[model samples]
Target chain A: MTPFSYTRAGDAADAVRLGAFGGAKYLGGGTNLVDLLRETIERPSALVDVAGLPATIEEREDGSLLIGAATRNAALAEHRAVRSHYPVLARAILAGASAQIRNMATVGGNILQRTRCAYFYDDEGSRCNKRSPGQGCDALDGFNRIHAILGASADCVATHPSDMCVALAALDATVHLQGPAGTRRLKLTGLHRLPGTRPDLETALEPGELITAVELPALPAGARSTYRKVRDRASYAFALVSVAAVLEADSGTVREVRLALGGVAPKPWRARKAEDALRGGPATVQAFRAAAESELADAAPLRDNGFKVELAKRTITAVLGDLAGVAA
Target chain B: MAIRINGTETRAPADPRVSLLDLLRETLHLTGTKKGCNQGACGACTVLADGERILSCLALAVQFEGRSITTIEGLAGQDGMHPLQLAFIEHDGFQCGYCTPGQICSAVGMAAELARGAPSAVTTDLGAATVRFTGEEARERMSGNLCRCGAHNGIIAAITQTYAGAAL
Candidate 1:
C-alpha cells in the first residue's frame, strides 16, 4: 500500500473538500478499497473516510425510501420497510458476499467497487487496460469464464460484480451525489458506464464526487418482486447469472414490470427491451422466454462464457414466470 | 481517542496501512483471532465491532477510533467459557481448530442478527420479523467461516445446540 494520510470527514462537505484534491479518494467501509490498496491497485495520496456520515434509512410518507449512502449493507437488508416493500433489494443484498462482508460494506462502496476480474487484480503480471490504459486486456484471451456477455467493448469485457445494484436498477433508484460543483442526481442505471474505452473510469461521478443517498421510488401496490442469483456454490460466491424483477400482472396479462440482470454485463443491465415486450402481453412462461430471448439477442459472449447467454435467459424467464404466478 | 478492543483502550497504529487484524495479532498480541486468508474471502479475521460482526483484515485500525471491538479473547467471561464455546468443545467442532475463533465470533454475531430479525439468504419469508433458527440457516450464516478440516457438521451442530433453543 502506498503511504497515505487518512482523515475522518466531519460531514459531506468536509468529505468533498478533502476528496476533491488530486490523488484523493473517498473511503467508505474500506471493504473493497482496503483490498485494492493492499494489492497496490489503487494508490491514492490521501483518503477521506466517510463511514461516519448519517447512516439513516428514512421512510417517506409518499411510500418511497431514502437511504443514506453510509448505511451498511446489513442495515439496508435488515430494515423492516425494505424487507416488506422492496423484498428484491433485501434478497439481493443477502445473496451477495457474506454476513461479515455485508456488515462492513457500505452502499456507496458497493456501487463503486471494481470489477472482480482476475486480470484486473493480477497487477504483478497481467496486463489490463483498466489497470493501465492502452495496455491490452488479458481476459480477452485468458480464462474468462466470468467475463462480460453484454454491453462490452473490444477494450474491456469485465462485468460488474454487484447484486444490490441489479435490484436497485430494477427499483428505479436515484443516486444523490455531492461534488465540487454541488449536488446532482443520476439514475442508478445510468450511474455505471458500460466499459467503453476507459474501464478505469467506471461511474459517471465527477472527480471527488461523493454519493450521499439513494432514493427508491414507490412501487405499484401488490407488485411482486424477487432476486435470484445462480452461482457455483450455495453461498459466499459471486453470481454467475442473476435476475431482479418486480412484476405486476392482472387477469393473466402483464400490467407493469421492471427487470434487471447482473453478472452478465459491464453494468447492472436494466432489461428494458424485455420489459417493453412483456407489458400488455400474456403472462405466460412462453411469453417470458420470448421476451428474455429478445433482450439477450445482442449478447456477445467470449470463448468460456457462452453458456451465460442461455443461463441468463432461463433465469430471467423463470423469475418472471414465478412472479406472474405461472409454472415455469 | 483510541479503539477499545476487548475492553482495553488500545492506541491506533501510526501507519494507516495497518489493518485491525494486524493491530490485534501483531501489536496487541491477541492471537486468538486467526488470520486465514487476509483478503476478507475467509472469515478467519471476523470480530465484533459494536456487537456487529465485521472482517478485521479489511478494517483499518485508524478507522475504528473510539469503537468497541470484541475478539475471541474477550468472548469468555470470568465464569470460564461462553456457552457456545462449551458447546463447541462438547460437539467436537474442530480438527485443527484454526477457524474456531472466527466461527465462534461469527456465530455469536449471527445469533444477535437472528434475534433482531436479520434474515439470511436461505430465509424463506422476507417480511417475517424473526426467522426460525434451523440447521440450514446456521449453515448459510456461517458459510463465511470456512473450515478445511470438514468440521462443518460439528460446527453447525454446536451452533444449533447453542442457539436453536433461544427465543429467536
Candidate 2:
C-alpha cells in the first residue's frame, strides 16, 4: 500500500479545506477506501478523517427524515422513525453488507463506495476505462457476467454496487453537499452518472465536496414498499439483480408507484418507463410483467450476461406482484 | 497516536496505512485478533470499539486515536476463562481455531446489541425494539465469520448454550 498522511477534520469547513488541497479524500468508515488503498487502486496524498461530523437523524415537521451523512448504516437501519416510515430503506441497508461492515460504514461513505468489479481492481492487467481513462474496457469482451446491461457506453460497463442508493432513488431522497464553492442539493437519481465516455467521473459530487446529509421526502399514506435482491448466495454477496419499489394500489388499480433497479446499469436505474405503464393500470401479474419488460426493453446485454435481462424482468415482476398481492 | 486497548493505553507512531488489525498484531503484539481475508471479506479481524463490533482490518490506526478497543485477548478475566470461552471449549466450537477470536468477539458484541434491543436483518419487523435470538438469527448475524473447518454447528451450540445460561 502507498503511504499517505492522515489528518482529522475538525468540522465540515475543515474537511473541505483539506479536501481542496488536491489529492485528498474524506475518510469515513474506511471500509472501501482503505481496501482500494491496499490494492493500490486509489493512491491519495492525504486522507482527511471525516467521521466526527454531525451524525444524527432529525425528523422534520412533516414526518420526513433528515439523516446526517456520517450516520452509521446500523443506526439508520434501526432508527425508530426510519423503520416505521421508511422500512424499505432499513431493509435495503440490512440486506446489504454484513453486521460488522454496516456498523462501520457511514451513509455518505456507502454512497461513495466503489464498485466491486474485478476488472477495475486489476490495476496491472485489466484494461478498465474507469480506472484508467481512454483505455479499452476489458469487461466488454472479458468476463462480464456481472457487467452493466443499461446506461453503458463503449468506454465502460461497470455497474454500481450499492443497495442503499437503489432505495434512496425510489424514495426521492435529496443529497445535501457542501463544497468549496458552497452548498447544493442534488437529487439522488442525478447523483451517479452513466458510464458515458467518462466512467471515471462517476458521481456528481464536485471535487472537494462533502456530503452533509440526505433528506427523505415523506412517502404517500398507505404506500407499501420492499427491496428484493437476488444474488449468488443468500448472504455476503453482491446483487445479481436488485429491485426497490414503492407502490400504492386502490380498488385493485395502481395509484402511485416508484421503481428502481440495481446491478443492471451504471447507476441506480429508476424504472420511470415501468412506473408510467403501471400508474392507473390494474395490479395484475400480467401487467407487472409487461411493465417490467417495457422498462428493460432497451437493455443491451453482453455475451455472458444476456440472462440478466430475464432475471431483472422476473425479479421486478415478483416484487411488484408481492406488493400488489398478485401471485407470480 | 495513543489508544486504549484491553484496558491498557498503547501508542503506535504515526502510520496512516497500517490497519488496526496490523497495529494490534504487529506493533502491539496482540495476535489473538486473526487476519483471515484482510480485505474485510472475512470477519476474523473483528473487534469491539466502544462496545460495538467493527472490522478492524479496514480501520486505520490513526482514526482510532482515543477510542477504546476490546480484543479477544481481553475477554478472559483474572478468574480464568470467560464463560463464553469455557462454553466454546465444552461444546467443541472450533477445529482449526482460526476464526474463534472473531467469532467470540462478534458474539460478545451481538449479545450487547440484543441487550440494547437492536434488531437484526432476519427480524421481520424492523420497528420492534428487540428481536429474540433464534439459531437462525445467530447464524445470520455470524455469517461474516467464515469457518472453513465446518464448525458452525458447534459454534452455534456454544453460543446458544452460553446465552441461555446467562439468561438463567
Q: All predictions: root-mean-square deviation over Cα?
A: 0.7, 1.4
With candidate 1 superimposed using the best TM-score fit, by how many Å does residue A281's alpha carbon deviate from the native?
Answer: 0.9
Over B1-168, each residue of candidate 2 has an lDDT whose tens digit, in order, gives: 578999998885577888999999999899999999999998999999999999999999878889999999999999999888998899999999999999999989888877766776678777776677788878878888889999999999988887743541
The interface RMSD value for candidate 1 stands at 0.6
Clashes of each: 0, 0
Per-residue lDDT of A110-188 in model 2, one digit per residue for the tens? 9999988899999998888999998888999998999899899999989999999999999999999999999999999
Residue A19 C-alpha lDDT in model 2? 94
Candidate 1 per-residue C-alpha lDDT over B1-168 given as tens digits, one digit per residue, 9 for 90 to 100: 899999999989889999999999999999999999999998999999999999999999999999999999999999999999999999999999999999999999999998888898999999888899888999899999999999999999999999996898
Q: What lDDT tens digits, residue by residue, belong to model 1 across residues A31-60?
A: 999999999999999999999997999999
Cα deviation in Å at residue A265, candidate 1? 0.6
Q: Worst lDDT window (10 residues) for model 2 chain A?
A: A231-240
- For candidate 1, the docking band is high
Model 1 TM-score, 2 decimals: 0.99
TM-score for chain A of every candidate model?
A: 0.99, 0.98
Candidate with maximal TM-score: 1
